[model samples]
Target: MQFATEILTSFLAIIVPFVGVFLERGCGIDLLINVILCCFGYIPGIIHALYIILKY
Candidate 1:
């Protein structure tokens, strides 16, 4: 179950880092930050999501 959840989060991160970060750590300022990064650039968003998933 953990593996599946991680996989899902990774996929979500690639597509929408905002949702991925929110799912990983629940809704908060981080989610808003990620959304802003995503708007600025895709790479930043994906990197932030991966960092979030790996960090927590």
Candidate 2:
């Protein structure tokens, strides 16, 4: 069950970047950073999202 949720979040992270982080952490600094990263480039946002998702 946890694995499935992680997988889904990972998919969302890759597809939409900060959205997964937003779902996981809600409105906060991480989400803000991710949004900024996304504004700069898609890859950074995806990377940050995956890191945050996997780490916490």
Candidate 3:
């Protein structure tokens, strides 16, 4: 289960940082905004995800 969760988190972090943020940081305005940014561009999503992970 732990392995699967890690894999899932890793995958989500790259392709869908909003989901990754939710998994790592919990639901909030930041999650919503990041999701929108992801829809706009993948790079921004990645940056947002990394920022969230590193920030907290």
Model 3, 1-56: lDDT tens digits are 97676667767788778878898878898898888888899899889887776665
Clash count list over all predictions: 0, 0, 0
Whole-structure CA lDDT of model 1: 0.91
Tens-digit per-residue lDDT, 1-56, candidate 2: 99999999999999998889998999999999999999999999999999999998
Off by over 4 Å in 1: none
TM-score per prediction, in order, is 0.88, 0.97, 0.71
CA deviation > 4 Å runs, candidate 2: none
Best by TM-score: 2
User: What is the C-alpha lDDT profile of model 1 across 1-56, one tens digit per residue?
Assistant: 99999999999899888889999989887888899999999999999999999898
CA lDDT of every candidate: 0.91, 0.96, 0.81
Ranking by TM-score: 2, 1, 3
Consecutive 10-residue window with the lowest summed lDDT within model 1: 25-34
Between candidates 1 and 2, the lDDT winner: 2
Q: lDDT: which is higher, 1 or 3?
A: 1
Q: In model 3, what is the error at residue 29, expressed in angstroms?
A: 0.7
Model 3 worst lDDT run, 10 consecutive residues: 2-11
